[model samples]
Target: MTTPQTPGTWTRARAWLQTHPRAWDATLATAVLACMIVGSFADPGHHGGPKWGTRTPDAPSLTLMVLGAAALVLRRARPMTVLAATGALSLVELVTGDPRTPVAMCAVVALFTVAAHTDRTTTWRVALPTMTVLTAAGMLAGPLPWYAQENIAVFAWTGMAAAAGDAVRSRRDFVQAIRERAERAERTREEEARRRVAEERLRIARDLHDVVAHHIALVNVQAGVAAHVMDKRPDQAKEALAHVREASRSALNELRATVGLLRQTGDPEAPTEPAPGLHRLDELVDTFRHAGLTVEVARADHGTKLPAAVDLAAYRVIQEALTNVQKHAGSEAKAEVSVVRVGPGLEVTVLDDGPGHEGAPQDGGGHGLLGMRERVTALGGSCSAGPRPAGGFRVHAILPVQNHARQATAAEGTGNRV
Candidate 1:
């Protein structure tokens, strides 16, 4: 078994230091000053091994070391200024001190800060000059020989610091870019999910409207007829009541199917009836005929098998159009429905020879015409509904016969060629 561990004192302290940059820089400067002061007392010229406390740095050397270390306190906020100040102090110590002090250590740290904060071009421009001037001063004017190890050490240490800082900067930039890309990708996925949800809601609303509007309109007409004729003619009233019952039953079945789309996966199974299509045009026209509206259907499309989406869109367009005509046109109105296959498309048109009504969908008071347009448009088709130039109203739609997969493949091919 594994156990989670709480943060230790050191971890907590490190986190706190990271949040307070000025304090951390001050701490670093103190440590560097301590190191420089201790190093100044060591002698490399001792007979045996190099010994500490065998020599003391002159006043000028001590002063340069203190100034260089003090400048590093503002290294992050003013990297370029710190580098210049420390470099000048190191050059002074290299030229004047008989035994050069460790003032150049502060310059190396400042150079590293500059590289980590600035771009590569700026770092390179600043670092090269600083390294050259410091190394040249140590080699040319110091009390020690030009070929001394200390002179070469300055060059090597400064180069390493600049390289290390640049590596840190590059890694940080790469990590930040990766984090931003992930966030943007997550946002895109969320937006796509929301868009799909909105589309699904609109689709369900249209389905409910189609089911309720068509069946209820028929039921309403039949009920009104049955109520009117009940006293005068019992037989005709019973027949009208039977028609109302049938219309209501059909409406209930369609409502169950439509509402079932919102059920959970483990819910009871819904009705398995196939969705109504152009194949059921006869049945659809009959219901309107029973309501006393004369409907005539003509077909020139042959027995063509359409993709499911196109078939459904065509059915819905016809259904909504007929519903509008039955509701808006007078009892003596006659309707004509035509299905024609032209070129690569199937066209459906509905015309009713009724005096145009102000309450019609063409006047923008209902969703019947709008739903038809949405259904056709979703299938990459076109739909138009308007009052006829002669009389009555007309609804026409043209739907492409291609399935989604074929259309997608053709689109991909075109994109590749382009």
Candidate 2:
């Protein structure tokens, strides 16, 4: 069985004292010096004075004792300096025949301060050497002859105090550096996550804008034409109404595809359908022409390739422009559509003359032009739609030519641009 713990035993003793190094140092020094003052009143033998006693300790001259007490106040600020001052005073007491055995105890306070504040290398440079010199000097030169146990006790205690203080200092520095590095790494991870999220939001916005805009515009235009012609040419009117049904169904399917982006867990399986591009321009033009608006499509000097977004944007610009003409211009209006490649970008323009109709009540919030602008701009392209200076309206768009190849090939192979 373990024995009961004592108030101040060797093992685990002073563990808490070691926690407050400076405070513990001051409290210990004051207690020890106060005890020494009391010891001065006793007889030499009764007060542990046969060898390790403070002779003449109660005498009128106690200059070294006073100096050692004053050194305690500034010990934390200048540990090594305070240690040096006390060590010098201890040496003077030993040589000048003063009665102060506890003067050697002052060196313990100095050693503790050196270990707590500075690194091992500095503690060794200042403390170990001074301890060796003072212990050796006192043993050889003090009134006590050589081989005195009291002098050797001073050396051992001072060495242990210095070692303990240095260990504490090193651990404190290591913990602080680790905390700072962890905080910096956490900040970097958060910033990277935010940047990636912003880029994905922009990408999803572009895809949804492209898929929904074109087919919806075509449906709106054809529906307008079907309503106008049913009263004049019923047979031809039925065909235009059929085209409007096809465009509306196509729009619903594309909108479903756009909404699927919200469930993006991984690589999505390819659907049984596909996206429409420029080759569909013929069918698109035919649908409007059947509706009684003459659409002339002019394509020249085609290139080998174009990006998917650019191809899609070009198709949408033409589709939206024609739809606007059918809605705003009179039934008799004739629209001219042109697709031409100039430099690295493709230009699609639809210019129409005034329909020769009177006073139209232009009204309602239409998503047509807004959707067209969104589509072209998503691909770093530009689209402009406004009333023509001649009499009607014109929509001109410039789409970069790099993405035209896949569109051209896809249109040719399908032979059905619908």
Candidate 3:
């Protein structure tokens, strides 16, 4: 008759025993000692099943059983030493006890502990000898006949214990390795995500700088012109103010588009405008022209369609180069822009005819040229910007067309560079 709370109490006791390993070992040793004592009172020579309480173990057998069970308490701490102690006790009982007790059970448990804690090579080295000596002693010297089942049982039990322990060890090692690999993969994924986020931030910063710098420069120039001509030339001043308004509006629109990338997908009023590319090159040049800077454009690209990334990179290179020209070159400086296709690559060049300023923007104080190089290099292209040997600054880039775009074009049967 068990109470309802009995199972819960047993569960808690088991958990506590597991948490305290020394206590658990002591409990196991006590159990083994009881089993050995009970077996010693059983008479195997009796008819039918063995009858308990028909025989009693001598003082020597009792002493050996006690010693063997006590040694098992330290099985996990010093498995080999515990095994040696138990094996010696079992051997003594096998050689001297007239009706041998089951003292070899402790040695089996100790062998198992040794196998579980040590490597396979050491397990084998220790297990074989322990099994051989105990089995040989029991068969040859014990009161039981040489062919008795008890002697053979010693060999079988010890072998099985070693094998079971090795199996447990192998499983433990395999699980640990899997856990470590999973942890390593998770860390790699996190590192890759952080790296990508950093790159995106740098790209957005560059876009913001380009948009604000280029348009704000125009707005400043137009506002200054509007102020200078307000009294003497009302019509000219009105036109400059209109240019100022236009530049400011364009700047706002571009800023909105760039910043909208940081918005959540469900956010309202997100910009749906496509990124500016070479298709908008004319509009870009016109904006600078409206600010009173002269820019000439020449193209030999044959209207070849480009990948969106390449087109956007090409457009930004020209935009940043021209913006530097407007800022660093004298007011009367004229800029020339060229786009040409030379075998599997597109070449873009921006050259200004202004006197070479001693500290041009491309001479490394600004993020404009640095951003340009980063964008080009990211796309596997090369960019060079410096003072030209002849006169003004030169910014040139060679962007390679990726094979995938050409392959897609070929798959479509167009037979032209894409």
Candidate 4:
């Protein structure tokens, strides 16, 4: 049994032909020349048919026919010029030669070349006159009679060549258009990827700023207190120094987590620690208290669980708020943090009692408030950071409690604990 042929073999053959265009053109030229030479000697004239008008061509006539067919070798390089040369030679053969030679073959090839490489208007412009003049010359001026089969054959061949070339040209244009569209789409995808990368870098920079600023501010304040009291109250100085170490350690850990996310590949062992959320609120408050800020915490959420993203956003907002109170609100500031569940979401509010400064702008000139609002907005939540009407600065964020991948992971952790 014979095996079926696959399209891959044909595809490879077509690719090879496309790569060797000059060889393909040379092959076409050779085939047309061979046909013209063979037809010249194969006397079709018969006792009664149209071949009755035939006679053998002479030596110079054969030479002229060869020259006409040879002109097609450069048809593709200069189609119109070659077509004109071949048309003139064919006219010469028609007017002077007996038993007409097939010099018209070269003109047909050149006309096809012109049509295939040019537009419809150009094809029409070139093809109509070419067909009319060549056919009229053969019919009116050749040795053959007016209604001879040879004259009609010239018209049919030229018209067919034009139509076939136009079809090929149309197919080529369509293929080129498809290739260009594909390239444009690929460029669009690359641009989109680059845009996403830039957005991610900005996000990471904001996270690093929030983390370093909050913890470092606490460390700076505690270090200053420790130095001022080291000679007088050794115990108080030691406690302040311990708080300094703890704040620095927290900053380093949070920094590692934020920076680890920037790694594009490979699980380089950084830290598998869970992100800080409501669970760490007490510790966060204790740090503020140690830094001489009296932080009061009130909760009405009643064990309401949150998605990891909302939890983290809530944590970051509160951290940045407290940090601002420490930095902008004077030493006498007392802050109140509230976490309450309302409707389908969790609301976190941080308020202070110190003398307030100018309100934080909505658009951004302050990184802390801007970063807080961005975090909340990304989660389909609303955030407000400004001076409270009564006393000091206020930060309020209401984040929805929707189920997501983070919630699922949190649930899994709870299950594993059980």
Q: Give one digit per residue, the lDDT tens place, for model 1 in 20-97.
A: 999899889999999998888887666776698767888988888889888999999999899999998998888888
In the predicted model 2, the residue pairs found to clash are 55-99, 115-165, 305-404, 305-405, 306-402, 306-403, 306-404, 306-405, 307-402, 307-403
Error of 3 at 93 (Å): 2.4
Error of 2 at 391 (Å): 2.3
True-structure RMSD for candidate 1: 3.3
lDDT, candidate 4, at 277 = 92
User: Each candidate's lDDT (Cα)?
Assistant: 0.89, 0.69, 0.90, 0.84
Higher-TM-score candidate of 1 and 4: 1
Worst 10 residues of 4 by lDDT: 45-54
Question: Could you arrange the candidates by lDDT from highest to lowest?
Answer: 3, 1, 4, 2
- Quote the positional error of residue 374 for candidate 2 in Å: 5.0
Each candidate's number of clashing pairs is 0, 10, 0, 1
Error of 1 at 345 (Å): 1.7
Estimate TM-scores for all models: 0.92, 0.53, 0.89, 0.69
Error of 2 at 232 (Å): 7.7
Which whole-number lDDT from 0 to 100 does residue 392 have in model 4?
88
Error of 4 at 207 (Å): 1.5
Better of 2 and 4 by lDDT: 4
In the range 24-45, model 3's lDDT, one tens digit per residue, is 9999999999999998888776
Give the Å error, residue 121, model 1.
Answer: 1.9
